[model samples]
Target chain A: MEGMAIRLQGLRKSFGETTAVAGVDLEIRDGEFFSMLGPSGSGKTTVLRMIAGFEAPSGGRIELAGQEVTGLAPFERDVHTVFQDYALFPHMTVEQNVAYGLKVRKVPKAERLVRARKALAEVRLEGFGKRRPSQLSGGQRQRVALARALVGRPRVLLLDEPLGALDLKLREQMQVELKALQREVGITFVFVTHDQEEALTMSDRIAVFHQGRIEQVGTPAEVYERPATPFVASFVGTSNLLEGESAHRIVGTPGTYSIRPEKIRVLKESAEADQPEHATAVGTVAEVVYLGDATRFLVDLDAGGRLTALQQNLETSSEDVAAYRGTRVRLQWHRRHAVAVPVPD
Target chain B: MALITRTAGALHRRPRLRLTLLLTAPLLWLAVLYLGSLSVLFVSAFWTTNSFTSEVVKVWSTDNFHELFTVPVFRQVILRSIGVALAVTALCAVIAFPLAFYTARVAKPKWRPLLVVAILTPLWASYLVKVYAWRLILSEGGLADWMLKPFGLGGPGYGLTAAVLTLTYLWLPYMILPIHTALEQLPANLLDASADLGAKGWRTFRSVVLPMVLPSVAAGSVFTFSLSLGDYITVQIVGGKTQLIGNLVYSNIELNLPMAAALGTVPVVVIVLYLLAMRRTGALSSL
Candidate 1:
């Protein structure tokens, strides 16, 4: 962990009897964009806060740049966080807000202004320096928060759902900008988000957390394609879980198997079994959902199991989908597409 | 059902009538009672009092104002009153902030409401009893002297200092309540954000907590300042020989009604000016 920006060794935190984060170990390399993806109460934010030195870990040690900082205060650590609500100081202008960290470190006033301006420029908020945070739009306020955290050139930047307040379009746009900014500054970013798409898109690597523990840690594709557990498979993306006899009939295994919705192909029941390298399932289309670019079909298999299949609407019209509402269909997919995972308790 | 629904619909259609009904009572009370009496008081301030008969003369004169400015005793009393009011306000603020912050931010969730109730419990007690209790505490050999005697010190012994201390204790709840509410409404995330941005606890309190709570502090001060400005009872009990503007007004009310009215206008003017200054600092919105 010498070259890592942040390392958590057996990190844990408990609020009385309820443990929030339990024995989590992670090594986030310097300059990499890492994300903790989980549902609420899964301890992702707690982990990020511990790294930023806000929450004292109940057990174990936290090393920032190879220096143990478990008992240190947030300001004592060379890290900063962009909070979920942006937390812009209402009384201060954007420049003052951005210059706060520098001022705390006793940076000269002239240099603080220059560095704040530079940081604001990096976030494309150059003219927003004089404006109060309340005067800015939500997206602009989030950018100022980012600038404030970034101005100090912290070793690791912890962001707890910084873009959670933005609307869909703005959130997507910020995702791209944040990724680019991470690359431009080459600073270690430890982001926390509950939105799976956000984690997949913005993160170089992601740790899927569940019940105060890391279920899986991998790159976006690895976590999505080869999810380590049933929790990861179900949480990271759209996964169709099959188990027991259905698992055996579908993938020749008697245990649980996970398949992606997009990987399953739907064909007319009477169509020739032309693709022999693929496994087959015969089921009636239980439900159909049209989602602009794709159509999702809930198929009830003959083996008493139901699985969902999503097909691109590239060559099919609404009429074609309606015609298949009650019709029988054959679901086909490569044998390699089904992944075996542990049964969740 | 139809009658009730129809009536509701009719009321919904006529928002103006509903608004008028909602506002009429308070508006009338303000116009007829509060403002009406205030206008009468200010009008009487301009009239003259007969020197021999003690009758308020109708002739427009500035004699009271002239005396208020020219008389050394009046000037001294006015400045002393303002000084005492300011000291009380400052002491209340200094005491209230930490107590409010503890109740709002630092204390456990189960204890917060209890702490607030403890702070407010004093308000329910009799004001006279509380003042008399303070007089006993400040008496030459009362609790204040007993507590300080071992430390090689003596109590303030019923002087300006005793008045100030008593007034601060009396008005503390007024200061604590608004500051506590403001601090309660302060988002916990803002403090976390400050800490996350590398600000120490004290620095965060100064730069983040103080500015945001200033408006509430000013609002609380409005209560303490104005109340202290017009209060003659506590001073009479504990002030020894101190003569504030309130004491002057009370002494003059029976002998010279016009002079009392003129002197009464001072606290009102001071409060209004203070509110105006506070409004410039955005305290009105917080209130």
Candidate 2:
């Protein structure tokens, strides 16, 4: 089960003049919740299609379960996909939608019902069998789509932004619910989404895509805390992008350096004793925003532009906006958290 | 905020209600003109016709319906009309389905416009002129005979067969466009979703594509069937003695308006029956 669930090697797709999915390569482990995260037109969906056998690659190969499935038809492959729109057969009831694949495979009546019942119950939708998809809410319909995909017992489940169409509250709930369901079933789920929070929340590992290529691939913490490229850094979360350079690999002004919003510390005149790693910056407070538990301040650097810093509002002194915003307050941070990356030209 | 103010606001809504009803005047006229007249005609079907006077006498009885079955020739005409309508509908659906699917699903951006223009060009030409052209082509020593001479598919051309061909050709665009509309509006992701769920070519069509477009198929076919049943020009011009309800109505209209109205109820009844049958197929209606 630790074998490669999907091994996409240099896959590419082009539509007439536009290259939708340029050369992309990645390997997903079996039973892992892997997410392909990218912006719109970043080829995440195209890669998902190639894995599902819906779109053939212009170049490169895909292997699933140790079998070269690059040229196989969609039915010939061992993959199931839940589309973003749910694509729950609108005309079909939840039970019939879940039973479609079994009927196609000519499964026996008793076995089909038993498997469908089990799959539906796994998604916590046991009593929704007789309801049509239109009668079901968006989240329920999405679960029906999940149940349909899982009922087939495919080797890999391709989810193309399955939570994108739900309300905010429902989407967040379903994300946790879907992650739990994935763990319960132990099926390799290849999820596609542009939502960075979603990928960070649920994925065991994520491949950040840009221009149809893997910009970076790692665990959530690795991708977030140690982004390898400018695109990955900015795509993961908000960062203060500053032009800096690296001399002898030590990182100085000339190339872009990412200072995480939380890494900045609001100081009085001297740095705290514990924050004595390196690369401290002194700036005056340009703007401050109070966000309940934490207050954020933008500090204008003497070298160039403004940098945002997030400070926890632990004391009543932090609430003094007149002392922070538009005031000459010093801010400093450690060097390890400020990683430098070359800007993409 | 008070009850008197609420009552005053409700009283001011009367003119808007009057305007809304006034806007429905044309629709009311159409309903009264079509439905009211058809209902009267259907009631007349229960009355018997006098054998000697050959006039329809208004009496409360089902004698005319019973007498309609007593003669084998009347049943033969009825069957011929039904057979022709059903044949036209089936032929149109078969010919249009693939072409419509290709236009909607697979055609390139530039090619779609060209294909649609080609399909619509035939409709822009005079419908009667098309019938006339077919009438000339189907006659003895006509274009069809000359064209088929090399292929050996000729014996001066078949009669009712030629009429069916002409009617199918005439209504082909009507059948194609609606099916094209339905197919075009069909979500591409649905087919993609079906494919990802282990449905191959035929299975995808059976499970996903066919059920979604069943309404369009029903609507387009009913239009072709009923239109062919009511069309006197194509069948009369191309067919010499193909005895359809259209020709039956045409023969009585000049000398006997009442008999023409009576015969008109045949195709109307057939269309109503077709629509009623279509509604039972579990497909949603957009009409």
Candidate that would win on DockQ:
1
DockQ for each of the predicted structures, in order? 0.78, 0.68
Specify the poorest-scoring 10-residue window by lDDT in model 1 chain B: B191-200
lDDT of 2 by residue, A157-179 (tens): 99999999998999999999999
Candidate 2 residues lying further than 4 Å off, grouped into runs, are: A245-256, A270-275, A303-305, A315-319, A340-345, B1-21, B39-63, B155-158, B253-260, B282-284
- TM-score of model 1 (CA atoms): 0.95
Every candidate's fraction of true contacts kept comes to 0.92, 0.82
In model 2 chain A, the worst 10-residue window by lDDT is: A244-253
